[model samples]
Structures are given as C-alpha cells and as structure tokens.
Target: MDLDPRTGNWRGIHSAPRDGSLIWVMDPNCGAFVMRWDDEETNPMFSDATGMWVASDGSMTWCEDTDAGPTWWKPCAQ
Candidate 1:
C-alpha cells in the first residue's frame, strides 16, 4: 500500500476523495481500505452498528463498530 499524495493517507486500488474531511486507511489485519473522519469528534452520531459517515462531497463510507469505538473502515466500492 502507498500513501495518497493528496491526503498522506493509505490509498487503495479504488480511488476516493481525500480532501482533509475524510481519509482512507488500510486495515492492518485485512489489508482492506476503510474510510474515517479526519476529526472523529465532529461526528456526534458515532456508535456501534452505525459507523457510516459522509464526506463533504456526499461520498459515504463505513467503519467497523466496536466497543473501542469505530475502528476499521470499509470504503464504499466504486
């Protein structure tokens, strides 16, 4: 995996936006690309089984829901 030049986050084969509001992250355990909010605190509705987040451009992504909070994110397929 390589860091996205635009956002400095991991990039996957499928391309997505990295405009600073959200970023792509690679799951160390599965090697899958997930999306996470650049600032988790801004997300007031974060919770288990409901980790879906939308970017400024209306692009949506999901993250794993866990007791530790939203963990691994799975980017929506293009």
Candidate 2:
C-alpha cells in the first residue's frame, strides 16, 4: 500500500490479479473497513461498491447510494 500524503488517499495491490488498483479509507465513525476499486477493466459489477468488513469472520457487504439493496455476503466457510 502507498499513501499520498497530500490527499490522504491510498493505493494498494493484492496477490490476485483480479484485485487490482485498490483505493482505501477508514470509516471515521467506526475506524473499520472501507475500500474500493472502480476501474472498469479490473472489476465491473462492483465498480462503485463500498462496504464494511469483519476481519474475524471474513465477511463483507457492499452497496451504492442508488442501489435498492446491499450486496449479500456469503457466510464464512466452516
């Protein structure tokens, strides 16, 4: 991950190729998960999605401002 001090923004990469060019932020209220990847060539369906995550359980759900419903997260594997 790299931080741009001027904008207080971040960029990062993961092991998977599909996990391309990530943008990140911290939820001021909760101080938890908040990240996005909107590049069309990388991720299409979730282009503008944003979500919170539970590290302990590996769970997340994403929704957009205009979305009628939040995207569902699959339960953690046993």
Candidate 3:
C-alpha cells in the first residue's frame, strides 16, 4: 500500500475494492499508535502505550488496545 501524494491518504496496493482508507497516528508522549478508518470512529484500532518493536530476524511485536485486553502480536505471526 501507498499514500496518495496529494492527500496523504493510504490506498491498498491492489486494485481491489477497499473498505476505507486507514490512518495511523503515533503519540510520542504516550508512545502509542492509533489507527482509524475513514468512516469509523466507534471502533478505531489502537496500540498499547509501550511502543512497537521489530526484531532483527524480521519479525514484529506489538499490542492492540481492545475491550478484552491488549491484543499481543508476536514474531510467530511473521
């Protein structure tokens, strides 16, 4: 995926129909990343305030904020 140069909106790499554009915002103070789609506000994606990390072996780890708890993503998914 890439961002539209003129609008800063992200688009899917493929030509398939997309649900909506995603927006990512990072809060330096809180060290959390937040994601939102063009039309949704009631259910936005959010990461924990602990920050995200990528291992040297080409894997990533992070957590998503949700009602259940912080959803963790480990290197195994990579």
Q: Of the candidates shown, which would achieve the greatest TM-score relative to the real structure? A: 1
Per-candidate TM equals 0.27, 0.24, 0.20
Per-residue lDDT, model 3, residue 28, is 25
Q: How far is candidate 3 from the true structure (C-alpha RMSD, Å)?
A: 12.7
User: Which residue pairs of candidate 3 clash?
Assistant: none
Superposed by TM-score, candidate 2 places the C-alpha of residue 66 at a distance from the truth, in angstroms, of 7.9
At residue 67, candidate 1 shows an lDDT of: 35
Question: Which residue runs of candidate 2 sit more than 4 Å off their true CA positions?
Answer: 1-20, 32-34, 38-58, 66-78
Ranking by lDDT: 1, 2, 3
Per-residue lDDT of 26 in model 2: 35
lDDT of 1: 0.41
Task: Evaluate all candidate structures by whole-model CA lDDT and list the values in order.
Answer: 0.41, 0.31, 0.28
Residue 4 displacement (Å), model 3:
23
lDDT tens string, model 2, 1-78? 223323534222222122332223333233323343233322245555443222332344323333332222222124
- How many residue pairs clash in all the candidates, one count each? 1, 0, 0
After superposition, which runs of candidate 1 have C-alpha atoms over 4 Å from their true positions?
A: 2-20, 32-48, 53-61, 67-78
**lDDT of candidate 1 over 4-56, digit per residue (tens):** 33453444423444344345444454444444444242334454343343443
Q: Regarding TM-score, does 1 or 3 come out ahead?
A: 1
